[model samples]
Target: MTLAVFRSFPDFPPYGGEFEDLMPHLTVARDGTPAEMRAVEREVREHVPISMLITDVQLMCGSNALTA
Candidate 1:
């Protein structure tokens, strides 16, 4: 199974958990090729979420950057 971590940034919620606020998320796509996996890993190391990796780096999906 792919390793996905959810790190907490700022501070952990009062609920209390192993992770803080920000988490290190990870996931392995069973259908993804070796090259794709490598790229995904890189994105994760850079703190990018899987969705962004898939859309921006892989370009497999549309990268719809929303405005605040």
Candidate 2:
């Protein structure tokens, strides 16, 4: 399942979700290897649901940058 919107957690463990200048995005692929991620993306386009609800959230920093 996947969502195409931003989400936030009220509070997360360890650091309590207090990072600065943070933004959330829909996670398309969770695979470690780039090849595996690509394969998963293909499957996601075919089988993922149109809508999804996030239950629990774990905050983390990613290296990717968002562009306009």
Candidate 3:
């Protein structure tokens, strides 16, 4: 899927093609202060093992815009 996206938009490679392999992840928080980040980590650790069904995905790009 990543490769296909790269092919379609040669100018906008995933992560600017910086990484050799991509690891699936979920962003819990962004730009949080150190103390806030620690609090988030503690909260997340309380639910160490999370499970869910990902039935669909939406590709977003370009600064708060939904691309697809």
Candidate 4:
């Protein structure tokens, strides 16, 4: 299993001296057969906390399904 984290900050300026908080995200991937990947996806969806939103998914280049 592999996990990736990403953070993004907007360019908009704040009213006060402080800038906006940075956004954080998490992405999980399991290198395996299609069936195994599906199983892992279901498990993660059920177990992971609700605060993190799995908004988008992009398979890595040469990755299992994307390459096929």
Over 7-49, each residue of candidate 1 has an lDDT whose tens digit, in order, gives 3332423224444464434444445889988887786678643
Highest TM-score scorer: 3
**Alpha-carbon runs more than 4 Å astray in model 2:** 1-25, 53-68
How much lDDT does candidate 4 score? 0.50
Candidates 2 and 3 compared by lDDT, better number: 3
Off by over 4 Å in 1: 1-28, 48-68
Ranking by TM-score: 3, 2, 4, 1
lDDT of each: 0.42, 0.50, 0.75, 0.50
TM-score of each: 0.28, 0.33, 0.56, 0.32
**How many pairs in model 1 have backbone atoms within 3 A of each other, for residues 3 or more apart or on separate chains, i.e. clashes?**
11
Candidates in descending lDDT order: 3, 2, 4, 1
Task: Write the residue-wise lDDT of candidate 3 on 1-65 in tens digits.
Answer: 56766787799767767798986667788768999999999999999677777765555666655
Error of 1 at 45 (Å): 0.6
